[model samples]
Target chain A: MDLEDTLLMMPGPVPVAPRVLRAMSKPMINHRGAEFSAMYDDCCEILADVFQTKNDIFIISGSGSAGMEAAVGCTVGKDDVVVTLENGKFGERFKKIADRYGKVNPLENEWGYSFDLAEVEKKLEEGAKAVTLVHNETSAGIQNPAKEIGKLAKKHDALFIMDGVTTLGGDDVKVDEWGVDIAIVGSQKCLAAPPGLSMVSVSERAFEAMDEKGELPYYLDLKAYKKSGDKSQTPYTPAVPLFFGLQEALHIVKEEGMPARINRHATCAEAVRAAVAAMGIEMLPQLDEFSQYSNTVSAMKAPEGVTGNDIKKDMLARGITIAGGQDRLSGKIFRIGSMGNVQPKDIMLTIQELEVVLKKRGVISGLGAGVEAASEVLDSLL
Target chain B: MDLEDTLLMMPGPVPVAPRVLRAMSKPMINHRGAEFSAMYDDCCEILADVFQTKNDIFIISGSGSAGMEAAVGCTVGKDDVVVTLENGKFGERFKKIADRYGKVNPLENEWGYSFDLAEVEKKLEEGAKAVTLVHNETSAGIQNPAKEIGKLAKKHDALFIMDGVTTLGGDDVKVDEWGVDIAIVGSQKCLAAPPGLSMVSVSERAFEAMDEKGELPYYLDLKAYKKSGDKSQTPYTPAVPLFFGLQEALHIVKEEGMPARINRHATCAEAVRAAVAAMGIEMLPQLDEFSQYSNTVSAMKAPEGVTGNDIKKDMLARGITIAGGQDRLSGKIFRIGSMGNVQPKDIMLTIQELEVVLKKRGVISGLGAGVEAASEVLDSLL
Candidate 1:
C-alpha cells in the first residue's frame, strides 16, 4: 500500500489524487505523433496558467536540480560573473550549479534567515550576468524576497532566475511581474504530480542570451526542448507516463482555477501554524517584515525534552508521515508539508496526531485544543 | 486509446505491458525511507542481470541520450583526446557529446555501414584517453563490432564506453568480457518500461577515473548517485512512479529469466526478417561477417514504387504503427521494432499488416506468403 495506508504530510509529493494516478496507467503513444503533440500542447497551455507567465515554458525529463542546472549552465558563460543568493539548501545548490559555468559572487545567509536586498544589489552592481534565488526555501520554511530582488536585478540588467520548486502552483508567483527571466518548478512539489519532471519557463531575454553562450550540455539544452515543444514533441524520448500524470494534475488545477488553489494552500499553511501555536510551539524560520513564512511547508522547533525525530517517530507509529529537519537542523525541528492536494481534513488529522504525540509527553495543554484552533482557522477561511 | 488500440511497432519505445503501466499508478512515498530503499535495491539487482555485468548500476532520470552524455562527459576531461565511432544518428550523438567534454577524434562512417577496426586501432594508438562505440545503432538497425573495438581499446589502454541503448536486454552483450568500461541502457527500449529513465553500469576503471576529472555537471554527477544509491536513495528527487514501473518491468523480466527473454527477442527479429525477405525487400544494414544485424529493430529499404512514409501511413491507417527512417534515410527505409514485450502473435500481426499494405501496390505476390514465411520462422523457434 505504501503511502496510501499512511497520511503523507511531507512537502512535495504530498498525496496524489486517484484521477491523476489512473491517467498514468494509459498505454504509451508515439511521442513524435499527433496525439502526443496535442496532449503536450495542452500541458504547456495549462502550465502557462499556473506559472502565470507569457514566457515560453518547456518540460524536461529530469529533477528540479536538472532544471536549476539548465537555467544557469545554458546562459552563463565562463567569463561571466553570477550573483548566487543563498538562505537554504536549494539556494546553495544554485551557487553550486553556477560555479561550474561562471564566476560566482555569493550572498550567503544562515538557513531560515532573509537576504539583504541592498547587499544583493551591490553584487549585481559588480556587473553580474545572472542572479539566482529560491522563491520558496522549502528547507527553511521561508519565502525569499523575490519581488524586491528581481527589482534589483532589473535595475542592473542582470538576468533573474528563480527556483520556485514549492511555490509556483500553491502561491502567488507572478513570473513576468517579478521580472524572472527563468522560473523553474519541480512536478512533485506544488504541482502534485509524480517526481522526475521539471518545467522551466523562459523569458525573451533569457532565450536570446542562451544562444550567445554557445551549445549547452546535450540533454538539458532548453533550446532543443523549445524547438520540439513548438511541435508538441520532445527533442529526446520523454517519460511518457509521468507526462500523463502531470497533465491530469494540471487539468485539475485548471478546473479549480489558480486563485482558488493558491488560497487553499495559504489556508492550509495558516491552519498548521495556528495548531502549532495553540500547542505553544515556536516556528523555526525567523521572518522579517518584508520576508514571510512559506505557504507550502511549516518548520517548527522541537519542544523541550524531546527531539524532532521523537515527534516524527511518534507520528509515524500513528500512521502519519511528517518530515524531520534535514542536515544541520536535524532533531531540532519538525516539518509538516502543506502543499499539493492537501486538504483541511489532512491538516486536521495531522494536528490531531501531533496533539496525541505531544499530550503523551505533556508538551501540550490538553487534547482537542490544537484541533479546535485549526478548525477556527479553517472556519475563518470558509 | 493512444497506442492501446494500435500495435506499436516503433524502435526504442516498444509497447509496455499493462502490469508495468499499473505499477506506475501506485502512491508516492518517502524516497529516503526503507520502502523505497528496498524497491530501488531490487531494481538495481534485476537491472544488473539484464546488463549482464558485475559492475555497479545507477538509475538516473533522463533519456538514453542523457545516459550517453553521462558516460562520456563524466570521464573525459577538457584536455583529453577521445575517439568516437559513428555510423548512425545515435553514434553521431556520442561524438557530439564527447566533443563538449574533451577533444574528439571521430571515425565517421555512412549510416548502416560497419566500422574498420584497423583504422579505429590506429586512432587509439595515437594515445587517446577513451573510445566510444554505439553497440546498437537503432537508427540504421545495425549492431557494431563492440567486442573487436573493445579489444583494440584494451590494448591501447583506453577506457571503452558502449551505448547499448537497444541491445543490452534483447541481444547478447558481454560487457565485462568485451572489456567495456561503461555501458548505457534506456528504459523504453528492450526493457519495455517508460522512456524517461536511463540506467548506467560503471566499471572500476571508469569509477576511479571519474574523480580525476573533477566534479561533473551537478545533476548528471555519478559519484553523488553512487553515494545515495548505496542507501537505496537518489542524490536528488527521482521519478518515483517511473521507478515503480521499472521495478515491475524488471520483476517480470526476472520471472521470465533473462536468457529466455533474450532468445525471444532474437526469434522475433528473425521472424520479421524472414517475412520481409519473403516479400523481396532489402534490409537496410549491409552486415559483414564480423558485424551483425540489430536484434531489437529491423530497418528495410522502401520498395521502388512506395516511399517509407507511404508505407508508414498505410500501416497507421490500418492501426499498426511502424517507424520511417530518420534524418538522411527518411522516406527511403522503414523500421519495425522487435524489442520489449513483442510476442509471436505481435510479430505475426505486424507482418500480416505489412503484407496487406504492400500487396495493394503490386509489390508482393500475395498476402499469405509473408505470414507463411513468418509462421515457419516462429515454429522453428518454438
Candidate 2:
C-alpha cells in the first residue's frame, strides 16, 4: 500500500494531525533565541497541564526512554535502592534503567496482570530511595496501579516516578494528586506529536534528591535542564522542528480540553472491547481491581484458527497499519490504538476492517456483528 | 521580522533547504517496521560516507552535546585519565562531560586561541585513557589542531575523540585516516538538517575499550545503539520526522559529493574573510601553524565603536540573522555561517545587507566595499 493513503492503527507513532505535521516543516530558528524561548516556555506550560502537576517540567530531546533515563539517573545514586515494578515491556525498561544507577529491587508480575501491592510495600518498607512504575503498559494493553504504588512509596518516604508515556494526554493522570515526584510522557503517543521529544515533570522533593546526587550523566542531567529551563532554554540545541510540532499538538489538546479528551479515549477503548467481544475474541489483559484495560490501545488474543501476522498483513494490504504483539507474545495477539485524535468513527472503521480480514480467513461467523456491537457502544456514550 | 522572510546566517540552526523541510512533513511510520529499517540503514550508510570513515556509526537522538556525552562516557571509565583540551565553550563542555565519567586532566587556552600542543602531549605522556578535542570550535571560530592532537593520542595509546559538529559534512574530515577513535557531528550545523539528532562514528578501538567499561549512561549507551543499528533500529523510538529530514539532507550532500561540498564551504569561508578584510574588520581567532580559521563559520571582531549585539540586531531588522559572541566574548564579536547549502549568492546577499546596516549606523566609510571584494572571490572560484 502507498504511504499517502495508509491509516496508522498502531498504539504509538500514531497518526499526526495535519497542522502538527505542517508545523514540523517550518524553517529553523536559533534555539537560543527569544522566539525559541517563548515557544519552549509555552510548550512546557501546556505539558504541566497535561501532567496535572505544579512541579517543574522539562523537555528532553531524545525519545521516551530519555525521559525515563533523566527521571532515574538524576535522582537515584549508586548507594540508593530503587524499587522497580515490572509487568510488561515498558515496565521492564524502567527496571533496566533503574538497575544502571542504583541497586534495584524488582517486583514483577505476569504480563497483563496486576502487581502484588503487599510485596511492593514490603520492598519499599525495607528501604528505597525511589519507586518506578509504567502507568500504562502499551505492550500488554494494561494500566498498572500507579496511584497505589505512589501511595506506598510516599508512605515509605521514597520518591515515586511514573512512566505515563501512553496515558498522560489521553487520560486523567494527576501527577501532583497521586504524589508522583517525576512523571514522563512520550510525544508520539497520546499527544499525537512526532516521536523525538519527551517531557518530564519533576517535583521539588525530586529536585532536592537530585541536588544531593553526584556525577549524573552529562546529557540527561535534570539539574542542567532545570537551570536552563528557568530561562526557557535547553542545556544543548534542541530538535527545533519537533518542538514546533509538539507545541501545535499541545494547542490542539488545549482547545479540546482534558476532560473531553479523556472521555473520548475511554469511550473509544470501551467500543473496541465491545466489538472484540462480539467477534468472540478474548481480551489479552486479565486486569485485576487495581489494574484496568489500557485506554490508549486494545490487545486481544488471536482466535484458534487465525494467526496475528496473517490478519495484520491482510489489514495492511487493505491500507490500515496495525501492530502484532511484541516479544514473547508475537503472533499470539493483535493490538489496535485508540489514542491521540482517534475517535468513535475511526474505531468503527478499524473494527469494520478487522471483520473483513477475519471473514477472508473463515474466522468470522457474521460479517456485520463486530461493527454493530461497536456502533451500539459508540452511540450510547459518544 | 516574520519567519518566512528571515534568513538565518548563524553557525548552527542554519537555514534548511526546502526539500529537507518537506521531507519532515511526511506521515508517521512504525519505527519497528521494515520501511523505517530501510530508511534508517540508508541514513547511517550516507553518514559514514560524509564522516569519511568505514568505522561503525550510530545516530544519537539528541543534540551535538548528547553526541559528545556519548562519545566520552561510553569509553572513559571512572578510574581512567582523560586529557581534555579547552579553548572555548564547547571544549569546556567536553571537559565537564569527561569529568563526570573519568578523571579529567584539563589543558586550558584563551578563547579564540589554540591549545598548547606540548602541554597536551605532556598530559598524554603522563598517561591518558582518552584525548578529547573539538575539531572546530564554533564559538571561537577556530579549528583546533585535530590531526596533530590525534597523532599524539595514537602515539600515547590514548583514544582520540573529536567533536566534528561544525566540520564533518562541510569539510574533509577523514575519521579513519586521522586515527580518530570517535568523531561526533550535530545535524543542525553543517549537515543542514533540523536539530534533534547527532551522528557518531566509532572506531574498532573505541568499541573494544567500551566493552571493558561499566555503568555507562543508560540513554547515551553506544552499545545499545550498536545493537539496534545492526537491525536498522534505535534502542528506543527515534525522532521519526527528524530522521526523514536528515535522510533528505544527506541525499543532497551525496548528490553534490563531499569533495565538491568541502570545496564550496572552503571557498565561502575564504570569501567571507576577504569581504570582512576589505571593510577593515579584524578576524577573531589567533591561529597557529597547526590551527586554522574555521571553514564552516567565520568569527570577526566587532568594529571598535560597534557592539556585536548591535550588528546582530541591525541585521535581524533587515530580515537576516547572525550570531553574537557567547560567554566572555559577548558583544565583542559576531559570527556568520558558511555551512551546508549557504552558497556564494547567499553570502553575497548577506554582505550587501551588512553594508546597508553599517551605513545606517554611520560605521561604513565605503558602502558595498565588502560585497565588491566578496564578488571577486566568488567570480574567481565558483
Candidate 3:
C-alpha cells in the first residue's frame, strides 16, 4: 500500500514522478472535447521532441507490444517477407507478431549479444518488406544495432521498424537520422510515466507501405489512427488519464532537458556497472566487442554460489524490486533498472544494498567497495 | 483546467467516481510482482461478479475497440464467414472489424432501431464461423437483442461475440444465461472508472474455437492472455493506475449492490426520458416497437432550426458536456449520458440546463416542464 516507499527498479513501470502521479489523479475529461484535443496536441508536440522526430506520432491506448503489433500489422500482410532481428525476448516478440501477419526471416542472435551487422545485411539481401529491430532489449539489458540495421533496411529497400521501448527518452534516439521508418516508445520506461500507453512515430515511407498493404486489423489499423489523429482524436477511445500523466512526465523531461537526462542515465548506469564490477560480479554481456549493456537496465550474471532469484528476493526484502532473468536465462542473471524517474541516489542506495545482500550470502568479501565505487561516480557527477 | 466543474455527460470517459480517482493516484507497482498478482486476482473476482459469469475475465490495456478486436481476431480466421448485426454506428464498427478477419454478411438495420431477430437468425442460418453483436450501441443509444442473437449463434454452431461497451455494468447483463461466448466491456462506461482499461469475459467454448483457429495477432492474442493470467500476469505491461481505478470502481459497485445499481441506472434514465418528452423533444427512436433509447445514454433528434452541434455548444457554455451525432448522423441528433458515476440529480440538472438552452432558442415554451417531469421521476425513485 505504501507504493512510494518501495523502489521499483525493474525494467519498466518504474517509479513515476510525483507530478505524473498527480496528473493521473486529475478528473476524467471528455475524450472528444476541445480540452482533450488541446491536451492531445500538446502531448504529441512534446513527444515529438522527446522522440527527436518531426514525423507524426500516434499514441496507442495499449502497452508497448500493441504499438509493436500495429507497426507490423499495418505494413506486413500475408506472404509479405519481413526480416526480423531477434537477440532477446522483445526481439523474438517482434518476430512472433510479424509471423502472424507475414513471412518472417528471423536473424537470431545470442540473448546477451548484439547482432552481427554482416549477417543482418545478408538476411536483408533477400529483399523484404520491412526490417524490425528492438533498440533496447530489456530482457538482456542490450541495445541492438538499430542505426546499422536501419542502414541495411534502407539498402534493401525495406521499412525500418524500431522498438525504442527502453531507450527513447533516457538516451539519444534520433528516429529520422537513424532512418527508423516506424518507432515505438512505451510510456512506462524511460518516459517516467505510468504504463498503459504506447507512442509511435511513423514516417511517410511507412505510411505508403501500409497503404499498399491495404487495410489491417481494425483495432491495430494505422490508417484509422492517422485519419483521426489529424483532428486530435483516436479511432477508438483512448486512456485519457494516461495521456495526462504522459503530458506531465514530458514536462518534467523538458525541465531536466534531454542532454542532461541522457547523461544522467549514462552516469547512473556506469556507476552501477562500476559497483558491480567492484563487488566481483560478472555482467551478462562480459564486455564483448559489441558491449550492448543497456543504460536503462544492467543485466549481470549471478554469483558463483547463488541464483539471480536469490538476489531479487533479497533486494525485494529491502524494499527494492530488482528483476531476475526471464525465459531461458531465468534464475541465471539479475537486472537493475536505471531508467525513468530513477535518480543517482536511488542507484547508490541500490548498489549499497546489493553489497549487503551479496556479503550476507557469502558471495563477496569486499562489502563496502561496491558502494564506495558507486559513490565516487555519483560524487563526480555532482 | 477546471475539469471537475464541467459535467462530462458523454457516453464514455464518463464522470469517474471520487474513490476511483483516488485509486488512480495510488503509487505504481510492479506489474509482474506478487503484490500486482494479488491485485489482479482481486480485480478478476470483482469483474466476474460484474459480468455475471463463471468464465475467465481479461483486463486488456487498450480501449473498448481493442477488446472488440480481440474477441473477433481470436475466433474468426481469414476467409471464414461471419454474421454481423449492424443497427448503429458501433454495430457498423463491429461489421468493419469482422470484415477484416473474415467474410462478413452484415444484417443492417436502421440506425435508431434494434436488429430484427428473424433476419439475424436467417443470416446465421447461412452457416458462419462467428456472429458479432453490440449489446448496446452507444452512438444511436440502442441496446440490441443480445439474448436472442446469442441463442441464434448457438443454434447455428457459431461463436457469439458481444460488445457490452455501454451496457455491461449499468444494466443487468447475464453472460452465462445469455450464452455470450465473448463479452467485452469498457472501464470508462458503465463501470464508472477512468477511460483506459477494458475487461473481457471469455467462455470455454470461445477459447476452444480460438485454439482451433491457430495464432492471432500478438498483442490481441487471447491465448497469451489466458497463459499469463493463469500466473496473474498480462502478456504485456498494463496500465497499473487504471487497474487500480477499475478495482476501486468494482469495490464501489459491490458496496452499492447490483440490484440497487441496476435500478438506479434505470430510474435515472427514465427521469431523463420523461424530462425530454415533457420539453417537446423527439427522442431518436420515437418509442415505437423497437425503442432505441439506452438506460446509459439517450439520443434525440435536434429541434427545428437547431442542430445537435448548436445544442452541444450551448450545453458547453453552461459547463456541461453532451455528445453530438457522429458520422452520418452528425448535427442531426444529440445524446446525453447518465452512466458511470452519474445520479438522478445529474440527470435532472442536465434536463433543466437543456430547458434553458431550448427556451433561449425558442424551441420550447414552458420553461420548467422538463425539470418538473424529471424531478417527479427522481422523487418516485427515492
The candidate scoring highest on lDDT is 2
Residue pairs with backbone overlap in model 2: none
User: On residues A1-382, what C-alpha lDDT tens digit does candidate 3 reach at each position?
Assistant: 5646798889998998877888888888888878889889988988898888999999999899999999999999888999998878999999998999899999988887867788888888888999999998899988877777777888889999999999999998999898999999999999999999999999999999888989787887888999999999988898988999999999999899998999898888989999999988888863346546798999999998899999999999999999999998899999999999788899988998999999899998757899889988877668
Q: Write candidate 1's Cα lDDT for B80-192 as tens digits.
A: 99899999999899899998899999999999999888889989988899999999999999989999998999999999999999998777888889988999999998989
In terms of lDDT, model 3 sits at 0.88
> What is the lDDT, from 0 to 100, of the residue A160 in candidate 2?
96
Residue lDDT tens for model 2, A30-115: 78889999999999888888999999999989999999999999999989999998888888898999998889998888878788
In model 1, what lDDT does residue A30 have? 86
Residue pairs with clashing backbones, model 3: none
lDDT of 3 by residue, B79-154 (tens): 7898988878988988998888889999888887766777888898888989988888888877777777778888
Models sorted by lDDT, best on top: 2, 1, 3
- Please tell me how candidate 1 rates in CAPRI terms: high
Worst 10 residues of 3 chain A by lDDT: A284-293
Q: Score chain B of each candidate by TM-score.
A: 0.98, 0.98, 0.97
In model 1, the Cα lDDT at residue B125 comes to 84
lDDT of 2 by residue, B150-182 (tens): 899999999999999999999989898899999
What is candidate 1's lDDT per residue for A166-265, written digit by digit as tens? 9998899999998999999999988899999999999989988888888687898888888887878889998899999999999988998899999999
Task: Show model 3 residue runs off by greater than 4 Å.
Answer: A1-4, A286-291, B1-3, B286-292
Q: lDDT score of model 2?
A: 0.91
The top-ranked prediction according to DockQ is 2
**Weakest ten-residue segment in model 3 chain B by summed lDDT:** B285-294
